[model samples]
Target chain A: MPPVVKIEEIHKIYDSGEVPVHAVRGVTLEIERGDFVALMGASGSGKSTLMNLLGCLDRPTRGRYLLDGIDVSQLDRNALADIRNQKLGFVFQGFNLLARTTALENVELPMLYGARKFTTKQIRERAMHCLDIVGLSQRFDHFPSQLSGGQQQRVAIARALVNEPQVLLADEPTGNLDTRTSAEVMGVFQKLNDEGITIVMVTHELDIAHFCKRNLILRDGVMVRDEAVSNRSFAATELEKLSSAEAAAKLTGAKT
Target chain B: MRFGSIIKVALRALMRNTMRSILTALGIIIGVGAVIAMVSIGNGAKAQVEAQVASLGQNVITVFSGSMSSGGMRGGWGSSPSLTIEDAEAIEREVTGIVGVSPEVRDRNQVLANGLNWNTSVNGESPDYPDIRSWKIASGAMFSDQDVRSVAKVCVIGKTVADQLFANGDPVGQTLRIRNIPFKVLGVLDSKGFNLFGQDQDDAVLVPYTSHMKRLSRRSYISSILIQAASADVIDKVQKDITEVLTQRRKGREPDFTVRNQVELAQTATATTQTMTLLLAAIASVSLLVGGIGIMNIMLVSVTERTREIGIRLAIGAHGSDVLMQFLIEATILSSLGGVIGILLGIGSSQLVSHLNGWPVLVSTASVVIAFVFSAAVGMFFGFYPARKAAQLDPIDALRYE
Candidate 1:
């Protein structure tokens, strides 16, 4: 079977200001279906730009991009939008759930703009199922403001998955969460990956990269490292270790 | 995207900023309201004038003594007394399609009756006066043709004259002294509120033109001749015939008379109100235009404020056209809703004006429909730029907008 995403000699340049910026130099990559990959880079390292190209949010300056076996690199803006709606999902760092909207409605938003028509009942059922997958079915009616940061991120993740897209692209999905909540969110991702959902996440944190099966690191607009994670961290095990360590510290303080 | 969803999304967005939306819609509301109110008041004035003109009786024509001419030194209508009693008699004999003819001789004098006195107009008319003027006598009866030929001392007193001079008793069968001449009140006229010229039509007593010309004022000629045609279809023919007969009677002398029909009277009376209505509507539409600008201003602000929301939608696979549709729907809903409320407000205010200040007011469905359509069009027209601006936004820059 062909890879879900295959990019050949992809390049992205920005001529916005006086000095031209080659945000992403020629980089070729491929990701098989159900693979969980992490993209790691420092600020200004063009990770975001590369992620945008992969998500079809922005087109590459020069390259061939095949998403889910369709060549999307030559498509117009509207066609790209259709590709995004039908095959690619996005979870942003800021948990970009529409404010004042309930979690279920936020999840249902992608379907509202999708190519296929859905009845209201079908949309509601599908959104509820996605929220259930993210452990947020109980908070379906809760607004983003009412949820904790981790819950809001979960809602955003549910929104990303509602379309059943082939690729889930998350940009710093846990950037604003605490360590325990970050681990919890990663656990959700790991569980989904175990069920054969492909994910590509971008993050600067080394520990966050360890949660994925593979890591690709960029520096100065070039890929510096591409390797399978040798000492991968499991979020479920890390969360367990964290709770035990907290229990031990509490016991020691009580004895003192 | 489905139209229903687009509308739902727009409504939700508007609800998010309820106060600002209401304020923006207020501009359209007031604009439409002003348009409706001004048109209604103008229409009401026209209706009042038409009703008053109709009171002069249907298919009626008037021959005044003075002609309207630009070349000669101007003397307004009724300035010269050239209509003699013979001229009225000649019109009655020669003119066809005429139902009634009355030689009107008007004078203002102190009338005394039932030990009371009042200053009122005394009109000299034939027995056909009541029928010609469409006036109904409340009691007794109009004097007979024999009374007119015999120069009877009988008269008909109007309601206002009756009220002022015979407050305690029936005016009919009583003595009404006009200019120190005692005349019997044959009947009392039903009240007619006022005429187009604001003259009190009911403050008058009617006597035979013979008595008015030969005894009351001692004048050789009548003031004007009021003629009623058989039907509306022949009023012009009747008027032309009267002019021809009168001109021939003058034996080739430059005719000193002017002819007018009810239609001309109505047109002349309503022309000012029509112009005023148009001017007011123009001014009101300017405000509606201002209101449209207000909508554009607010929509631009909303587009700026919701840039982040737009970015998120775009990233989630919303087409630029979707964003445009959503914003356009939002503006249209705001304006059309304002238009509906404004129509109600306009009607209510016009009714209040009519009730409180005693001014006439008419609310027409055509105006309401026009106001609604205009407001909606205004929304579409003014909303285009901002909606396009939102639709053309770069998703990357918009998503990153702080």
Candidate 2:
């Protein structure tokens, strides 16, 4: 089977009157199925732009973007949206769950726009299943405001996965979470990846990038490094260590 | 997605800001309410005119003395007593479609009965007067031709006169003195209520033309001639025939009388009422336009406020058409809901006005339906630009919008 995502010489140029900004320039890359990859870059390094292109939210200025053997660079906006709905899932840094909506409703949103007609009952069941996978089954009726930052991110992840998209694109999924919560979120990603769902995450944190099996470094809108993570961190083990360390710190403070 | 689910989504979004939604819809509410109320008032006025015309009798024609111009001073129609009883007789005999003719002479006189005096109109009419005027005696009987020939002082009192003179007691067979002449009340006429000009129709007493000509006005000429046509379809022809016969009798030297039909009078009255209705509806529609503008303004603000949400939806696979449809549905729902509330308010207020002011009001179903559909169309019309603005937003940039 062809790689899930393949980009060849993709360029994104933003025109603002007199000055043209080259947000993404001639980036070529490919990701195989089940590859948990982290895209690491500093601010203004075009990682977000690259993620947008991969998610079919934008068109490249002059390049080819093959999402699962389909060239999406020339697709219209509606067709691009259709591909995003059917073949790709996106998780945003802001945990863009609809405000005032329950966790289950937010999770069921993507299925509402899916190409496959899903009955309301089926949508509910699938949403519940995805929420269960993210360990948020108990928070189904809780709104975004009622959920903690970690739980909100988990709800957003469940929303992304409800349609069963092939590749999950997460843009700084744990950027707003505390260290322990971040590890817990990463553990969900690890579990999803183990179940054969490919994930490409964009993060600036080196420690978070270490959780992925591979890391691609971007600098000044150019790919600088693409290498396997020789020392991959297991998120479940890290979360365990974090909880024990917090427990020990609390005990020592009490003794003092 | 199915259309129902799309509407469901829109309803959910609107419910999130329930207060704002209701406030925004208030404009349409007032607009539609004003429209319905104004239309109902107009309809009521028209119906009142129709009832007045019907009371004037079906297919009845009147011949009034034409305007009298003396020394550049022009007097209105019926100013001169040019119409005579001879003219009425000639029309009755010569006109083929004439059903009945009555020569009328009127005077305002003080009438006394039961030791109480009331000033009212006293009219002299032929025995055929009741038939021509479409009036019926409520009790006793109308005077016959023998009474008219012998100039009997018997009179028929209208409801208003009877009530003024006798109160609850029956006026029939009672003696009433008109202008110091004691006249026996032969009967009481049924109530006719108010005419189109808001004048009381039941404030008169009818006597024989011979009695009025000899005792009351003491005039040989009649004020006007009332003629009933054979049927409604022949009123125009009968009026023309009267004009021809009168013209021939006057030797065609600027005919002295004017022939008029109730149909024409009714048309004129209804036309005036219709013009008033249209003017009121037109003025009320301006508020509906303003309401539409209010919708557009609020929708624009809503689009801006929910830009990020729209981007998120678009990014998640919602087409631009979907976003557009969602906003459109939201606006339509708001205005339609407003329409329903306004219809109820309009009906309530119209009834309230009718009850308080005693003005006739009719809430037509067509007006309600028109106002509702117009409000919904206003929603769709005004909602387009804002929905299009939202639909045209780039998902990537919208996602970054604050």
Candidate 3:
């Protein structure tokens, strides 16, 4: 079968006054199904920009991005939005849960945006199922303010997985988590990957990048290191260091 | 997205700001209330005017003693024999439109009962007087024409008089001693409430003209003559005919009398009431305008406050129409609430006025409906721009709004 993702020389040049800032320049890439890849780059290295183009949130200036083998660059805004709704799921740095909404309601918001939502009683039941996957089934009624940072991020991951999307676009998913909590989050991603959900995440952290099977490093909007991670490891045992002596504080995510 | 979900979200957002919603509805309340109250007051005044006109008797004319010149104290001004019983007879004989003619002799006397006495008017009038005055007897028979020609000593008492003399029993056939002269009771008159002259029409008695002529006789003079034409349409013509005849009888001199009809009086009073009602409504509508401004102001504040919420809703795939519909509904709801409150208050206020001032105020259902509809329209009109502003917001900037 054809590749699950494809890019044909995609370019993104943002107009800042008279100067043209080349946020992404002629980047060509592809990934097969069930691939766990990390787009690694420094600040302004076009990795996040390429992720956005793939997420259908922004368009490439002069190239085609074939997400799941569908050319997104030629599509209009509404069509692009339809693809975003149907195919892709997002997890951002700040965990972007609706402020006043409960965790379950936040997970249910995306399902409500698609057609057949009214007839989709299964959408509500499935939201619970995803929350179960993220280990937040008991906190379905808790609002974002009532949950800790790690719990909030778990809620976001539950939202991304609730649709059972084809690809997960995680923009620094563990950027706000502690070192131990980051490992715990990576363990969840690895487990989801092993269960056949494709993950394409962006990060500058070397330890975070090492958890994925494939890595693409970028500098000045150009890929310089495209290599396979040697061991494709996760530090799930790092969570054991905080599990003892400070179990309550670490589990509750208290500063102490 | 499902419409049910949209509505649920909108309702939740509305519940977030309670005071603003209530304040927005205040305008609609005042507008509707003012309309209902003004209409009720107008109805009251119209009815009052009709009743007052009824008291005077429609199409009736009056001819009085007047304008005696080069004479004594009661001489030059009102000592003329212009309204003699002969002239009353002449009008009865000559005027084509005159349906009935009653000559009157008004006098003030101490009306003596068993022990109580009252200083009430005693009208000396012809037997045709009841028909001429548009009167209906409540209890006994009116004196027949025989009472006028044979000059019987019989009288009809009004309701106020009957209440005083025969407080527990019938006044018919009872004898009342007027100026030490006994007159047998003939009938009791139907009540004619009060009039502009501050006189209760029921507080008087009527006697046969001949009996009064014999007891307090006059040569050819009457206090006033009561005349009813065949209909209101011919009243003015008949009045002109009577005045010309009387003027000629008084030697072609101006007759020095007032000729009035019910239509003119009703028109004058109705017009006055209508103007007063419109003025009241205009005054009340100023409050409605202020309420509208309050709605607009609160909407602006709401738009400012929910920027982040707007962004979240948009990002979750809320369409532009959804945001627009939500804000518009909020504005309409607010205005309708105010309208309801204003209607209740307006009716209450008008009822209070009616009770305090003895005026009739009727709040019509038509006016109430008008007020409610007007408030809703105003809400939509004032709510449009702010709602549009909210709907058109860019999700990127809105999410970043503090």
Candidate 4:
């Protein structure tokens, strides 16, 4: 079977100013089915730009991108939007769940804009199922304001997954969460990956990179490293280790 | 996207800011309300004028003396008493489509009857006078043609004259003294309220033109002539025939009399109110335009305020057209909702005015429909620029918008 995402010599140039800014320079990569990739780079390193290209939020100035074996690099804005709707899901760092909307309604939004028509019943059931997948079934009716930071991120994840997209694109999905909540969110991603859903994440944290199957680093808009994570960290084990460390600290403090 | 979902999304967005939405629609409400109210008031005035014109009698024409240029000194209508009884008789003889003709001589004087005195107009007319003027006889009968020929001292007392002179008894078979000439009352005319000129129609007495000419007015020429056409369709033909016969009788006398039909009188009376209606509607429409501008201003502000929301939608696979449609639908919903409220408000307030002020107000369905459609159109027209701005936003920049 073909890889879910394939790109050859993808380049994005920003000519909005007198100075031409090459944001992404001749980056060639592939993401296989069920692969979890952490696209890592510092600020201004073009990781966000590459992520935008991969998610079809933008088109490359020069490249051939085949998402699910269909060439979408040259598609117009509306066609690209359709491809993004059907083939990709996105989770943002800010937990971009629409304000004042319930978790279930946020999850159901993408389906409302989908090319295929869905009955209200189907939409509700499907949104519920996605919330269930993210362990937020009980919190479906809770609005973003009502949810905690981690719960809100989870709701956003459920929204991303509701369309059943082949590749989930998460841009700093846990950047706002604390260490423990980050692990919990990573655990959810790991669980989704285990269920054979591909995910591509952008994060600057080294420890966060270890949660993925592979890590790619970019420097000056050029790919610098592409390597398997030899010491992969399961969020489940990390969370367990965190709780026990807390328990040991509590015990030590009691003895003192 | 499904149209139903788009509407749902738009309604939800509007409901999210209910206070702002209501404020935004208030402009349209006032605009449409003013339009409806102004038009209704104008229409009401026009209807009242038309009703008064109808009171002048149906299919009737009048020929007033002296709208002529003699020796280069032009005189307005009724300036000089030039129409004579012979002219009225000639029209009655020569005009084919005329039903009746009456020579009229009008005078105002104080009279005594039943040991009481009152000042009122005394009109001298033929036996066809009551029929020509559509005036009804409340009691007793009109004086016969023999009474007119013999210059009988018989008259029909109006209700106002009867009530004033014969306070305790019927005026019929009683006497009313006009210019100190005692004339026996033959009948009493039914009360007709004030005319368009605010003149009380029932505050007068009718006597034969012969008696009025010989005893009261004492002139050879009559003041005017009233002629009733056989039917409405023949009014123009009958008028033309009268003009021809009178012109021939004058024999190059510069056509001293002016002929007028009821239709012309009605048109002249209604023209001012029609202009007022149009002017009021025009002014009202300017306010509506201002209201449209208000909508555009709010929509522009809304687009800016909800930039992040639009970004989220676009990033989540919403097409630009979808965003445009959503905003457009939101504007339409706001304006059309305002339109409905304004229509109800207009009707309510007009009815209130009519009830409170005793002013006639006609609320036409056409005006309501036009106001509604205009409001909706205002929404669409003013909403386009802001909606287009939202639609043209780049998803990448939009998603990144703080």
Candidate 5:
């Protein structure tokens, strides 16, 4: 199958009123369908800008970007918006759920803009199915403020998958969660990957990057390394180990 | 995005801040309300004036004698009787549009009837007086031409004179003594209420002009000629014809009379009321403008506050136009809602004002529709800048907005 995302020598420049800032300088990469990849970089490495370009939220300054075999770099604002709605989903570190909206409505947001028309019943059913996939079926009517941090991120993941996009782009999906909660979120992502959903996530932690099958590192707007993970960590097993360790610590404190 | 969903989203957003939305709409409410109320009052005043003019007489014109200069001391118009019974008869004979013409001679005198006395003006008029003045007799009949030719003292009593002189009975067939000359009441004139000048129109009596000329006043010339045109459209032409014929009869030395028509009086009254209404409506529209500004101000603030929400919607595949439409629809809904409420409030308040002040008020549907459309236009006009500002926001920048 053709690659779900293709970038050839893409460059992004930002005009900061004085000297121009080259946020992404001459980068090229590809990801096939169903591939689980993590992009890793330090601060100022231009990883976020690269993600924006790949997500079709921003156009490349020089070069072409093909999302699902279609060149999207030259599309106008409305066309890009349509492409984003039909073929892309994004998960942010902030969970970005509309504050007063319920989890089901948040999940339904992407489908509301989908290319295919959906009735209210279809929208509700599809949103409920996505919420079930994210293990948030019981929290469908709960608001983001009422949900825990981990659950809110799960709702965001459900929102990203509601439109059944070709690729899921997540930026620091676990940045605001505790260690065990991060592992729990990674477990949900692992299950999605096993079901043939392509995902490209950005993170700074090497340990979190190990949860993916492939890793790409950036340095100062350039690709520094690209390789398969020699020993990938299964999030389900890691989460089990974390909970057992916590249970053991609680037992020892109770005996003391 | 579908239109229904877009509206739903806008409604949701507005409901998130109900208090702010209501306050923003208040401006339009007051504006539309004031416009409707002021316009209604103006229309009512105009109608009242028209009714008063109509009551005086329909298509009626009056020819007043010119000022008389006696020994270089000039008296005002009608001070000298230049019009005559002959002139009134000539107008009826020569004018093509003249329906009826009556020579008038009036004097204030004490009228006694049924042992009760009242001070009233007694008018000596031709037999065609009732037809020319559009006056109807409640009972009995008007004096005939024979009555005028033979100098018969038959008269018609007005409603006010009837009530004051014959409090417990009808005045028709009763004897009324004017200038101590006993006159038989022929009929009672219909009540005309008060005129625009606040003068009681029914406090008068009508008699045969020959009777007044031969027996009471002994005046040879008549005071004025009350001419009724055939129709409203021919009033100006009739006035002109009367003026020309009178001038020719006087040998063109100088116009001995001034001709006036009710059409001119009606136009002047209508124009004044219309101007006042427009001024009031213009002042009321300022509030609508202020209301529009209120909407714009609130929309700007809402855009700034929802910067992150806009970013999220954009990232989720909302076109810039979608975001623009969302805010624009929000503003429109606010103003239109205000417009509807204002219409109701305006009508209610106008009715209230009419009840309290006893002033007639007519709420025209055209004005209501105009006020509504104007308010919606205000919403769209004032909403554009803020909606554009929101639409132009970069998705990447918006997502990062804290």
Candidate 6:
């Protein structure tokens, strides 16, 4: 059986005026179901570009991209959008929740866009369940602006989980959090992965990458290493040691 | 994106920026209001002109000799030196379109009846004059054609002249003087009030024109000849025929005489009034254009301000069409609000003015519809660019917008 993600000789060129810069030069990678993978690279190494392509926000100039064994390389804009909504969920580094919207509405966002034929009560109940998964069941009425950065990131996680996407892609999901909060988020990802959910994340920090079972490193738009993390750092006890609010307070500085 | 959801978001977002929305809508309001007010005024003037022309009697045509002027209107430029009692006799004799012809000999002067003597006009004309001018005898008859032949001293007095000359009792068999030439009143004319020109028709004394010529003035020249055509359809042809006859007689080659058709004159007056009214409206519409520009400016700012929100929505699965609709609805709501305000203002002011002047005003519901449609168009027209800008924003970049 094929892996859940398949890329064949993908080339992404950014055309600036008359010059075409090779943003991603012929990368091919794959990951099977029931795996947690991390793409690690330094800044300007096209890590974000590969993440954008993986998330279906952009298309490669020339390549065959297969997500869940479906040929998605040639999808138009609207089709790509629909695929993103139904097949993949995204949690960005900055949390990217709507500032004026409440936590519940933010979590309810994906279900509203989905074709699940859910009623208002069902949508609200599912959103509440997702928030409960992220352990933010009580902050549903607070706007994103009122929440701390870590809480905001958890709301984004709830939003990503509300529609039960086939894969959850987190791009530096703990980049804006402190050590304690990052450990807590990693614990949540591990717990989710243990429940048989497919997870992919991007990070440049080696310790953060250690939390994942598998690691993929990119350099100069090429994957240099693909390996499982050995003796990975586990934050199983640390997450339980601190409350979310106290853990979230550790991420008070150097956001983004 | 769901179309209904797009509109709902747009409306909610617009509600957030209350002041911007209202200001934008103000532009549409002014445009719509101006349109309604201008059109109503034009329509009112049209009706007024119709009433004034109708009062002049439907089939009336005046034959004077004149060429068309540069200013577009003048009555007595006929090259002819002669439009005699003879031409009136001939039109009465031969013209098929001629309904009635009264040789008008008007001489303005003061007249004395009693202690109530006042300045007034005296018209020397045939009995057909009153009926052609739609005047009815209030108490006594108009002077007969025999009175014209015999140059009798018989006279008809108007209501103003009647009230001024005789305080009470009948003015019949009463004596009045046109510059101290004693004339006995044979009858009193019905009140015709004022015509469109504000000229008082009931402030006159009527005597036979030939009597004015043969006895008092001792001149053969008729000041003007009042001719009534059979109907409006024949006024132009009758005008042409009158021109030919009078020009030949006065100028002997091509008469300089002017023949005025009441129907044609009425139409010209109506046209002039309509053009002026439209010009006023066009001037007012310029302010509406300024208002639309104000809307555009505010909408553009709003789009920039909401860039992050737009990005968030897009990431959540909103298409470009969704973003565009949201902004467009905001603009539309703003303009519609303004339109309602302007409509109320225009209606209120026009009513107040008409009431104060005691002038009849007709405001139609069609004007309201037209104003609203124009206001909506203004919103769409001004909102399009900002909407397009909002729609064209990239979701990734918008998410990162500060």
List all candidate RMSDs to the true structure: 3.3, 3.2, 6.6, 2.5, 2.3, 6.0
Once fitted onto the true fold, the runs of candidate 2 whose alpha carbons sit more than 4 angstroms away are A247-255, B67-76, B79-86, B93-99, B108-120, B145-154, B163-171, B174-184, B194-200, B210-220, B230-234, B248-251, B267-283
Candidate 4, fnat value? 0.70
TM-score of chain B of each: 0.88, 0.87, 0.76, 0.91, 0.94, 0.81
Position A77, candidate 3: lDDT = 48
Off by over 4 Å in 3: A1-33, A45-84, A119-123, A163-167, A213-230, A235-256, B1-7, B19-138, B141-155, B163-169, B175-184, B190-192, B196-198, B204-267, B341-372
DockQ (CA atoms), all models: 0.68, 0.65, 0.24, 0.72, 0.73, 0.32
Reference A-B contact fraction recovered by candidate 2:
0.70
Q: Give the 10-residue window scoring lowest on summed lDDT in candidate 3 chain B.
A: B70-79
> In model 4, which residue pairs have backbone atoms overlapping below 3 Å?
none
Model with the higher lDDT, candidate 2 or 3: 2
| Cα-based lDDT at residue B251, candidate 1 | 95
Best by TM-score: 5
The deviation in Å at residue B377 for candidate 3 is: 3.8
Q: For candidate 3, lDDT tens digit of each residue in A58-102?
A: 788998888787888978645655676678887877787877789
Clashes of each: 0, 0, 10, 0, 0, 25
lDDT score for residue A103 of model 1? 92
Considering summed lDDT, which 10 consecutive residues are worst modelled in model 6 chain A?
A247-256
The TM-score of chain B in candidate 5 is 0.94
User: What do the candidate models score in CA lDDT, each in turn?
Assistant: 0.92, 0.91, 0.79, 0.91, 0.91, 0.80
Instruction: Quote the lDDT for B323 in model 5.
Output: 89
Ranking by DockQ: 5, 4, 1, 2, 6, 3
Worst 10 residues of 6 chain B by lDDT: B74-83
Q: Name the candidate that leads on DockQ.
A: 5
TM-score of 2: 0.89
Flag the better candidate by TM-score, 3 or 4: 4
Candidate 3 residue pairs that clash: B25-B334, B25-B335, B25-B338, B28-B339, B29-B338, B29-B339, B40-B362, B44-B360, B68-B76, B84-B220
Top-down TM-score ranking:
5, 4, 1, 2, 6, 3
Arranged by lDDT, best first: 1, 4, 5, 2, 6, 3
Local accuracy of candidate 5 as per-residue lDDT tens digits, B110-145: 888778899998889988888876788888899999
